[model samples]
Target: MSFSSVSPSPTNHHQMTEDEMTSENSLLADRLHAMLHQEFTSYPACPDYTSQADHSSTCSPHSRRAVVNDDWRRKICEWAFGVVDHFEYSREAVSLTMNYLDRYASYAQSKGMPLSRKSFQLAAVASLYLAIKLEGRNEQGQRLTISTLVELSRGLFSVELIEQMEREILTALRWKINPPTAAQFIYHLIKLFPVEGIYDVDAKRVCNGILETSRFFSELSVYQSSLAIEQRPSIIAYSCILNAMELVGPVTLPCDVRQAFLTRIAGITQLREDMMEVYNTRTSLRELHSAITDAECGLPGGSSSDANQGTYDTSMLASTRVSPVCVSGRQ
Candidate 1:
């Protein structure tokens, strides 16, 4: 299917009656709930195994080795985000790319093939390439080209290698790549808010800012292996939105109303204690939150003290060296 075919239409900003707004919100929420369930069911099995203590020991040795620690994964994700920014890809592209990487890696592990650092990086690049092709489009609505992707990689990878890796990833994943991401859920979640009527201009703006900020945190969570692998995407989306709302302060909805909304979301998403654990970890992790804040502020050329900065970061990430062949082969 064409990217434009599935792309979400912009929310109509025209004034509407409260009942109309509520009806629209209900329909969108139902669709989103169904999408969330589909994505949750489509997740690779490794996430479930990782969440279970007894099952951890049963995982193959190669699987264990392929699972990079959170620190390295964070650095890799930061570097990948830089590339995504350089190419002006949407956050959805990044989210989808990360999803591909995690699922493919898990599949490889299931087959007793651990990915090396270099292999993992290659997988990330390949996933991004696939995501851009699958989700990105130019102003004229043309799909991005392979040469452009090769150039973006700074010649670290050849087209053949990427093509080969893409094939391998697809084979490993059995070609399932359209899984819903946290960004999608966030978009739908914001729609659930009553950002209509005369006063909605500022309210909508605030909600958009909150959604963008939450997306940043959600993308950051992708690198934290535990949260990325263990928690459901819906949970991550919900947590990030809540965290962003906290940062933005109460704007459109009152405190009690917000709580009630959250309760409804939790019930709809069927969230469990693990969701709270993920949220608590994200909010309490000072370094991660600070890094995300800096990254978000730096996006719009804002200074460190600017809390109300713009979208995702555009700054180049600090270089972290890795050997081309430091680790062994994937198989």
Candidate 2:
């Protein structure tokens, strides 16, 4: 007899028992509460300067309008995402890096310090470096050295400049480096699915698909300047899930199960389908995902091929409007 014939079938593998569901819910509740509490504390404040004074006008040359803005931040976000992907590092680290950069930018602007164009790029590199060290490990399980970061900058910044920028970011962020990113929230929120007593393997597979797609949406959200300005991780996370669910539609994911899962999410996050914020976030993510898809199809080599090759072509990336950042090697 074959081994399969002798062994018993594990039919209950996809089923989540009541006790397990309760335990998962309790743990997720506590974690989500802590994330919401810190969300307000570490969230970036809105820029105070709306209108830019003319360069020849009475305002100082280093006005907030003349310095860093959402465009610059968006470029850094794109570059950082490519770097993290090139190194096989966790993309969540990119989100965390943006958290550092955005909060630091707000603090600097509030304090009357000019985040010069050069300083912004330097700060972005340092932010990514710090985030990677905190949460990423190479294939060999080693942290990348400062020298690697300098090389990634193409020697535009030396070790000393990178170190100083890192220190400045830390000080400005009050050393509270850990922000509850949308990607983190996505995983936690997915745990609240009403999976109790469900034994269908197909159902489990669909749920997992939704989760992976939701994470992709979260990654895409990192590149949107408006989403960064919105600064609500929990809502953003909820919106990603909702958009993913819509993209999957009722055909693949049964309507009853989908409704139950969404109900559980709304109960925990207080995010109603009718709320304007949720509607806007979902709309933005859907549009962004569509735009990215169109852009990728136009590229010479698709993102999947580039990822498999373990390198990003700076030339091709520049064609996508991403800033020139050296990410030419594996970790």
Candidate 3:
């Protein structure tokens, strides 16, 4: 009975007969409409409705139905930024992709391209995949794959046979995403401990190994076409990398995984030395940027937007895109 909850039913047509997938799709569309109904309905005629709590006073009859779909999309994104999102990075990345898509929607319109909210989501998921790949990791089969994403998008559109719509959306978004380099993630991570100077020893140590292992794993990647990339890794790769660092220098390690770490990290001779540089550079940059920004702190929206803008930008998000996916309840 709570909004956004569509109880699972066996005939989930996204898995069965997709054309018959109307009920669930309608529920999602309706949920979206409910969330952003005000924004959609109050356009043009209802200018002052935005200033009022009960927006119904100014919405036109014709505008109400059509805009409901758009409002529904806006609501979905709001929900995504709320509960259920796992990583701040993921949320930010997806949000940016959505905003770009919204802007591109205008472009698509100008170019006579048909783009629906569902098509846009596919592009966003594809962007997520490419971002992960550029960030130097990958997922298989069940995640972010083109076919799966297209199927996942089934419920976000209308029942009007949108086959060409999906194709057009894919055409508009020629698979591209901006990957934050390791240094970018590292710089941001270091800020969580914000005081700057020397990072915690273990944190510094693991970062070094992450870079080394990143290269090591990059080489190993050639053979991975045969590996099930989506297979849940034994431990999150970063956690595994941290444990690997315990193998280096004064740190102790289990003989086996330890030996593997040393072997893998050996690909880069300057491993420890690089850690020192990363630590120094991050520490110094943090101080420099902090000093510069602190003076600009109270300049209206400047500091606030500055705080929110990191590797990912989330300024124009219009909806939450829940994966029709139910991964293991693991965080």
Best by TM-score: 2
Model 3, which residues run further than 4 Å from truth?
1-59, 68-70, 78-89, 109-142, 150-176, 179-331
Model 3: per-residue lDDT, tens digit, 1-331? Answer: 6586786577674556665455554554453334233223321011111112124324675544333134433343333333223222343333333333443354454565434444544444443433333333222222333343334445442323233443444464443223222222222222222122223344444444334433222212111211111111111122224422333443222235344433433332213323543344334333433443465421111132332221111222212334334111113
Candidate 2, which segments miss by more than 4 Å at Cα?
1-17, 42-66, 196-201, 297-324, 327-331
TM-score of each model, paired residue for residue: 0.70, 0.78, 0.29
Weakest ten-residue segment in model 2 by summed lDDT? 48-57
Clashing pairs in 2: none
Candidate 1 structure quality by residue, lDDT tens digits, 51-126: 3322443478664455554544556666666655554556567677877887776677666765665677778878
lDDT measured at residue 90 in model 3 versus the true structure, 0 to 100: 40
Candidate 3 clash pair list = 32-72, 33-72, 74-318, 76-319, 76-320, 77-319, 77-320
Model 3 CA lDDT for position 29: 41
